[model samples]
Target: MFRGLSAFPLTPVDEDGVDLTAYAALVARLAGAGVDSIGALGSTGGYAYLTREQRARVAEAAVDAASGTPVMVGIGALRTRDVLALAEDAQNAGAAAVLLAPLTYQPLGDDEVFGLYEDVTHHLSVPLCVYDNPATTHVRFSDELHARIAALPHIGSVKIPGVPTGAEDRVAALRALLPASVALGVSGDWTAVRGLNSGCDVWYSVLGGTFPRTALALTRAAQSGHADHANDLSDALEPLWALFRRHGSLRVMAAAASHLGLTGEVNLPRPLRGLDAEQRREVVAVLDALGLDE
Candidate 1:
């Protein structure tokens, strides 16, 4: 189930809210191009920005566009009950699963992390995938936390960030303890092959957002033991990554969307920041070179 290309599509909103046409077109484009799954409200969708009620409405829109594809909703609220409520909303919207991120800030003890999982999983029937984007979430999935989540009956697994530097040996040690059923994958492309080679069972990515065809190609190549071929596309995708590495991805992506008329307001939450005119132009240039502009 965690095998193919999965995209995290942005939530298309305007001053009036919810641009169904833009949202539908994006979903239809990706689904038609062979993206195996779709995740709404993931980092790509600016999940943390939307209020709970707004997220519910946006999620409902996603489920309709999902059309039976494995739609995963990012359920990342600071509070446990609200997270569980979003998971319920995901289920209600027919989402295939909910992507849960651990509570951020205010450090959590091991027991607290496990308890959070137990609380959310209590009301969930669909599978739950944990997101370990520690840059924002602030807590890494320590080995003990991984073990606890894997033991849970409903958590399918996690989308952990790239393994930490100097942690390769530790990952080799850790992999032995992780169950095959609880798979792991990172979120970027150049790193994706490494992740897959490192025994991550799936590839959940934002690269899939603009380049689903290329992303699926990469996944197929890796799965077929053609990692070198995947590497070639990763090279082609380097410019996109460069945009992300230099400034930021989510903001650059919003600018790209505005450039393409996908959304009117390319806004990030307060203090998240955006690229200026010069930086935006550079991003558009890269996208233009990639033939990504609409």
Candidate 2:
């Protein structure tokens, strides 16, 4: 369940609290595309912005819409108590696994971070993926820290940020620290090809959420050792990657999904606006140029 392409769909929302209809449609689309797993409430899913009840509903909706494809729900929260609650909700909702990042308000020490995992894992009935997303969570995981956490029960996978292109050594070094049972998945859509080719076990993808076919092609090509073909596939989507680099994957994907009529015009939560008209026009052009809209 932890390996291969794990598509993280955006949790589309509007004036109505949790847009379950639209969000479920997105998950159904991903499952229909045959992604290895569906990751709900991940960063791209706007998990951080949602309330506990909203997230619980999203988790239930994703599992229902996934059509038996393994669903991994994000259970990250600033407080360990909330994380535990979210984890329980996800497990009860039939999530195959839970993704937890050490979400922070004040800076957390390594011990505090490890303790958070220890506390949650002790009560978890399902597997947990350690989400090492420094860009959003502000809490970074050292190799030693990761080793410590992965040793805990229920630690099934570790989702690391993008491995630099051609940085096989980095992946190898991290893999060496993890238990053989713990899968190493990569995030950051732009670096997926490099990360996969470098020997990561899974792609925890933002792009896969909205563009599963394109992302899957790239993932399969790399996983099959067709390095040149994978690179070519990634190059073909360079414009989209550029947009992701420029405007962030969350916003670009929300815009692209809206353009594709997969979700509403105002899908993001409050304080987070979708791209303006001009940026969206650029996205459309890129989608058209790459034949991604087809």
Candidate 3:
């Protein structure tokens, strides 16, 4: 049961490979910050960009550094076999749960998506978090499909991405549709307060990994019904969120981490470049304005 906030830590990479030292330190920071769980190899972690071996090493490092905090490893892949292989690897590495997104080259239909999760859930003892991220996967789960997945054995939670307009109604509808056992989490830090206050059980946050103290404070405020405080905190982080929207969180986060001296210059896998100097300067200004220049 990964309730509250689950921080999705970045997998710092260099010319050599995944930087285990930086990766572990990030995980330790999140665990010590008192987040409910750590999500390794997530979109923030660049799971789709890593080789199988690299992903395994990333999972192992995350679990080891978690220090009793639950670690949920992303096990999404283009193929069913690859997804299962990563899920098995996560289990062997002591991951608490596996998150699955319906990733495919061709557009996937409802039955195909259902079948993919069905096959994976059968082989696992640990719980699965149904990841409905249409932005990346391009496959959205309808309410009916979500209910079908939730009814499957060994499924624990559902992670819904984005906090679209009328999010309260969306949250209320999903809360009514999903089983009480399946907790819904809201991604996209901008929507976290609205989603959490709307009955989502957790915030699957990217900011939480890089700046856990502030993220945790916001979550606590939202959870305790401090709408004004939560709104103030969300407003404070709006500048960084604006950059996240413009340049994408992956690039902005890598730049943010390096700016904070938490990692070396992160070279994401090929075809992805970090922020240009101009964008980096904007990030620096945002970080400094928010007192995150450390």
**Candidate 3, after superposition: displacement of residue 223 in Å?**
1.0
lDDT order, best first, reads 2, 3, 1
Please say which candidate is ahead in lDDT: 1 or 2: 2
lDDT of 1: 0.75
lDDT accuracy of residue 226 in candidate 2 = 96
Query: Of the candidates shown, which would achieve the greatest TM-score relative to the real structure?
Result: 2
Listed in order, each prediction's TM-score against the native is 0.91, 0.98, 0.98
Off by over 4 Å in 3: none
Those runs of model 1 whose alpha carbons end farther than 4 Å from true positions after fitting are: 14-16, 163-174, 265-273
- As a whole number from 0 to 100, the lDDT of residue 78 in candidate 3 is 95
Ranking by TM-score: 2, 3, 1
lDDT string for model 2 (54-114, tens) is 9999999999999999999999999999998999999999999999999999999999999
Every candidate's lDDT: 0.75, 0.92, 0.89
